[model samples]
Target chain A: MSNKARVPAVDGWFTMDDEPKLLASRGVETGSYFFPKNLAFSRNPAAPTEALEECTLSRRGRVWSWTTNHYKPPAPYISTDEFVPYTVVAVELVDEQMVVLGPLATSCDPSELSIGAEVELVLGRLYEDEDNEYVVWQWKVVQ
Target chain B: MAVEGRSVSDVVVLGVGMHPWGKWGRNFVEYGVAAAHAALADANVDWRDVQLVCGADTMRNGYPGYVAGATFAQALGWQGAEVSSSYAACASGATALNAARAQILAGLCDVALVVGADTTPKGFLAPNAGDRPDDPDWLRFRLLGASNPTYWGMYARRRMEMFGATPADFARVKVKNARHGVSNPNARYRKLVTEAEVAASPMVSDPLRLLEICATSDGGAALIISSLEYAKAHGVTNPVRIAALSTVTPSYPNTLIDMPNFSTDSSFGVAAPERGFRDSIAHAAYEKSGIGPQDLDLAEVYDLSTALELDWYENIGLCKEGEAEQLLNSGETTIGGRIPVNPSGGLGSFGEAVPAQAIAQVCEIAWHLRGEAGDRQVEGAKVGLTVNQGLFGHGSCVILKK
Candidate 1:
């Protein structure tokens, strides 16, 4: 399996302390979320960290809309060229009066996703670069 | 404001054209040419007569571009018309429209043509090649794996949680737009989508389902615009006068985490942030036209996702935040209702064509104002408005009159 891909070579960002990691920037708005400094990742690399606050409060929203990652994320996202389907869901949070983004577990399928299904947030990785798995927040139907 | 209804430049739209949006196998230039030609023909003017041309650009395709001025000029047979290209994500078309209006208003051109087209690649649109640690799109992809839909989902979830908007409410919007899409000859998924169908759509991001979301497509849209005097000299008396074209960038200290690829700005940066991004766009238009949202008979907003449409309602002052749902559900936002919105299927129905989408929204208002829209016409759509917000804080809005 061709695991490591030469994505790009660039400067990495860091916080008050820690070494910079490889990063890809666009215009400004860097190191905000996707490309946090290595300091942030080194703090808790294994799990998804909340940016502002993670309200354990459950939100009651019917599924607003959804799309399936029928094909695995393209090149830079995953290690293999193989295609895998991942359901991407958008659930309306009940009380927060806002929305959150996340990925569906790989076990989900397009046929399985329907509108108006009560859903909740799920944090996981889409794929992994050899050094670290590309992690982000996603959603799943809250059975 | 206008106590006696003072006049502005009053540019008129002569013609509008668009390439049918779908998964067409073609390059962006092809769609652009088709729409440009259609606009020229619709205007009853020859391509050679066009004095200026502007194109909206796509970043995925715009990296290291040769300004696309000559490329698009060549695509439309290279009549040597002045050309310009704009890139502002989904708002590129509107930005290009702004450039064309500016040139015409500045007396730099007689009749200007604006065109925007895009042939989107399948799957989540990602950042460009190479690692620019400072680039926000790249950082988001690297850190969050939060694809474009993630941000859309975030707003959707937030809206529901913050407000009492139900998923069923969001589905109603999809159903309404899908019905409109089915009638639109240029829309990608034109079948009438049902609320139940929207409910049944599999979850792609979270609460958002497949049917509820708008898809990326290959298409083009174009417009032919002329200063009022030019239109009158060209044996035209009545035309859709674009009273104002406003394109404003977002101010600093924006709280909303707009880019799923990146987090909200640290706010610790600069003081006296200019203004909220979306408000600035509308304010610029109002400044130019000397009119407020109260004068708008109808509007077309960027509905990249259903929830964003609600945000626009607040931004444009259609109603207060969290009140858009009440407004929509009350049928106050319908075609015959007060302050009708998205009467032309919107991005939800027509699909996004990058540079062309914004221009196309204006075309819809023009058509409605001209009393040409067959079914989705807003009644007495005089003094129409079109508003759009693009990535990187780029935004646009135009006020029009007959």
Candidate 2:
């Protein structure tokens, strides 16, 4: 990897730590979790907007479903010189009781995963420019 | 079956029409106007007699597509008729229909027209051109490169893992729909498809081949509806009537992963709803019309993917969960089965025209109810239903009876 600066493709969605967790908002009264940190208000109608609070989501989950994208998607997706098919997975967190979707780590093969395979969140480089690397959250198999 | 103590009067479908689905590279307004004219002629009502027009908006075109109600009205030579526009992604057609039906029920207008049409681009349907990171549709593409097919593939794979649904089972859905399409003059792909053909087609998303997934196309569909009194006054007797319409959203703690979203609603705090979002769409209609699956002579479900059709079979209560493949294998969902589905070829043959699709489903159902569908008609078909869902939380279902 080049010694360029590391930055998030979309800022404030996650942290750049070695073991990353998704930043999210939770309904203080209802306990509902929202990814990407919804500070606007509580999605639950039973709760008030003042009940919303920011928090980090669970870092580990089980694969609820998965698939391989065989074709390159159109933009705002940034692709490298040659497009490579990647595996997308939906992982269900036990505590949150919700399924979150993301791409598998670049080093992991899709064949290595099953419906209930364990996975953990990680930070990975999505695309890189000359001076900086754009990163996003990815799911890695928990061996 | 009818809703007891029902205060709302039924809306009669005076006539229905469609512009043939294809890759026609033209202005969407042309298709909408053609469909509207055909509907007016079929209803035998003068265009000037139409009191209201409800339009399903298309995003592909510019401001005109966004305000499609006025767009179609202007193209059809506006006579100062009241107009309304609605957009709920794939459910736009049904939503617009519901809008017109509600107006008629509220005594706002006696005679109304519902129209939806679209002229799609070449490839995958992308989000609006912008750099907005706040949009989930845009963020999904920018962050994970996950296209719509990715979700379809995952759903198919989940069915395989949970219910042992094989790829062959999914292919058979396409084959059956393709056979149905051969008789539908308005379908985009009329050629019969075989399981081998489905298998041979390229795979856009694994576990789902290109042929098994719907393609985007240009199309338009329209319906002229009115109060029962209005239909009777026009000398139209025994017209098909809209019995129920459900345009509901997902309940709190919706756990099912849906399209254009990164995560499902967390159910840790709030308890999950009694019914999943998809199940609730048709359930609400069934409750409203008091017509269950057993009463349905035929169904027109959004078969965005062949597997999704099988999922709809269960969601609409044609079969129990994990038993849709069994229903398919038993020849129950085929054209000659106990409850035929997608006799109009579904999205498998027509592809998708976004705004026009849900209305197209209604048109197919109304045709069957009125004994107007030539070869694809279900024998003695009386009651029919159409179900579709848009991106985010839009849920749509409509039930009709002769």
Candidate 3:
């Protein structure tokens, strides 16, 4: 097997630019990405002060929908004995009508994913498959 | 039982009709036209009298980018009353219903017709065309082999573990709905499904068998609704009016519904999520109509699978959480029972018709409230509800009255 670390079949799903990153528009946007090889990582592009702005969107949406996953994904995804459930949210960006779906922080729950709740995009770990760790994106409650 | 407080001047369902739901092997547009004509005839109005047309779209229905309204109107003879199309997964039909009602209520049009139709492929619903790797629905199927039933299976297992519901309880819902569907002339499965037959059926997903799951089929449903004043002036008295239309999104348990996606949010790390997101659709309706769940003589919920029907029971507030199985076992959810759910045989008997299913739910409620349903009538039934949740978290719950 080639020893070069891979993005794990995910780089094919998104419409990435130099950074090989998409704003999570299509296919699936919930998987977390391990950094260091964004193909084009630009820190503090627009909002220099924001912790998440350089990584993803700037305070993208008022939550469109949300959910807490108390169950782990099957093998090849999560090896934890029923890994701790996470939250998945579909946030409609403030600038666009786009709805981005992803996992919420491990601490999030159902009460946080209401119709008109406020949500912000942040970089987080989704899960891992085999050898190389699998990193992905996520949403967190602004409060 | 009186719950939601509804507007007395709400729009009335002037007409409702449906093409038989089954494997008809016809294009979706053909069914749309047929159902539209049937609705016009039932409403005692000509098709030319329709002022606005709204459509719920099927993904394969030839919309370059999913434009449903114009596609359906052109098929039905473009007399051009304002037209639009909407998509909300399974909630498309209910979304269409609400759009038509809004236009009439907003005085944009006095008479409006809403239609939803589909000629679905057999077996699992395949995702959008080809190699595009970003769709969650598509990724789930291609990667994890999580077909639709897999989602249903996870939910079924969760319900069993969390609510103490048994597989047999899920089967009872199918048995009850099939018994009711037998009376519906348009229902695909007219024969009753026995509990034993369901148990004997081959498993599609664990805890759910082939019989326990609903099939995909072709169907068309239409509704002609008008301002309450317009109905009265047209000499159409006692029309079944739409008192409330609630299209809500997945909330609490919505947290646990992760597939082809990574782990669910850790509720153990934080406070539990709210149980109100899904349940509030009907509750919101009750608040608008002043009618309680007990006041609803009948209900038509999206039973994509038998286990899902149990979920709708709690969501629609028909029974307390975990009590759905008890309610089904006691026949409280059967026809002639206290609150007959899916009296038109529901999707269990109807199969998955995509766009048309939610509208069909309202159509059935209208027939029951009007006493026009000869065999499947809910005696003294005055209030009824229709509930469904579509793709991308689009949910709906509508309340109607005679």
Candidate 4:
């Protein structure tokens, strides 16, 4: 893992740093926030015609809901040849009031999660190639 | 936007047909052609008599599937019938049905044929092939690894927390639907399931076992719709009439965590609608039909997951919110009970053929209303409703009356 270059599976989704946060876009007129950045258009009815501004989302949130996947999803979802079950948590962002879904940190267990539990964002490897590690944002319950 | 009041002209279902729901390993066209012939025969009309044809688009079979209306017409030996195709994920059949209704109401056609057929892939459905990072469907799978069951599990977990619902409640939905399936001749899974069996099944997602969720299957269903005047002219009376067709999109700031979405729309700027998307779907149907839940003799809901079926109970106003399990326990949702749901076994037994499932729901309603659903029949069935919500915020409801 040491020699592999770490890269986001998709660019412009989130940042990789000490305090990671999801990249988002906010409608300038309507004040509506969008995840994965609404690069094309705004869905706001009041201010349907407006430009979106780039922004960083809240780094911490509460668990709105959680689940564990016991089956491997078909592609284009990348996974190891020997698949392992993983947990996913829908985190309700404190500031945005929007529930964002993502896989839990590799260390987290599904049995330990509860609704309203606090969690923070962290970048984790989704899958790795010989030369690169594809990373995506994951949620970890705050200890 | 509010839907206009009731339609001016009423559309009637002259006949319905299906190719059954299962993994047949056959071409979709064959299934569609078979269903079309069956429906035409059931309607007692020749292919040459159909003035319009509407087909539900399927994603798997390339251009022919996309241009389903013409594909089916060609297979059935077209005689210059006007054609239209619609695609709305799982609601494709309803879209096709509504398109036919619109044509009949507009005096464009007196007799119309609506067909939906799909040959689904064996496993979990994947996004369309591409490396396009922008597609949300692709992005969700690539970034979060969130399968369809993962979303269902989240909703189930949330319901358990908010409503004090237990896993057993979810299991009971399967048990009930499975029991109903035992009597449905066209259902894929005809064996009855028990709560113990459901609980023992391997977990697909937390709070959702393998038995609690529906699988993909290959199937076809078709309907023959005609104007009430046309039906009367053709010496048919008291046919099952389409009282209302509600096809609605969610209001802005859709709060539900729907499929293929990474996050809920932020409710920060605009206030969310009073009713959730599913509730609004049923509400629109109620408004258009001028009928309340109390008037429904039976209902056929999209039970993609057993837990989701419970959600539909409340969404369709069978009972108040957080009281679906109570209704289920009271036996009101069973075949003999009041407001019996999924008497034809629903997606729990039928599995999902995507395009065909919604049409199949209407077909089941037609059978029960005509008192022709041998064994699975609901006694004295008059008014029936079918509700289905599709990916990307498409919701459909069809109200039928004998």
C-alpha positional error of residue B3 in candidate 3 after TM-score superposition, expressed in Å:
33
| CA deviation > 4 Å runs, candidate 2 | B1-8
Candidate 1 vs candidate 4, DockQ winner: 4
Candidate closer to the true structure by DockQ (higher is better), 1 or 2: 2
Candidate 4 residue-wise lDDT, A55-122, digit = tens: 99999999999888989998888888889998889999877979998889998887678999999999
Task: Name the weakest run of 10 consecutive residues (lDDT summed) in model 1 chain B.
Answer: B1-10
> Which stretches in model 1 have alpha-carbon errors above 4 Å?
A1-72, A79-143, B1-8, B60-66, B130-134, B268-275
Itemize residue pairs with steric clashes in candidate 2.
Answer: none
User: Taking the tens digit of each residue's C-alpha lDDT, what string does model 1 give over B88-130?
Assistant: 7777877788788777767677788888777788756667878
lDDT of 1 by residue, A37-72 (tens): 333321112232523321132323455544444334
Measured by lDDT, the strongest candidate is: 2
DockQ list for all candidates: 0.11, 0.88, 0.05, 0.85
Q: Give the Cα error of residue A84 in candidate 2, in Å.
A: 0.9
User: Lowest-scoring 10 consecutive residues by lDDT in candidate 4 chain B?
Assistant: B1-10
Cα deviation at B119, candidate 2, in Å, is: 0.4
Clash number by candidate, in order: 56, 0, 46, 0
Stretches of model 4 off by over 4 angstroms after superposition: B1-8
Candidate 3 residue spans exceeding 4 A from truth? A1-7, A12-143, B1-8, B250-254, B258-274
Ranking by DockQ: 2, 4, 1, 3
Candidate 3 lDDT over residue span B40-124, tens digit each: 9998877777888889989965662177778778877877578878888788988888888877777767888899899887667
lDDT of 3: 0.70
Per-candidate local distance difference test: 0.68, 0.92, 0.70, 0.90
Residue A117, candidate 1: how far off, in angstroms?
Answer: 22
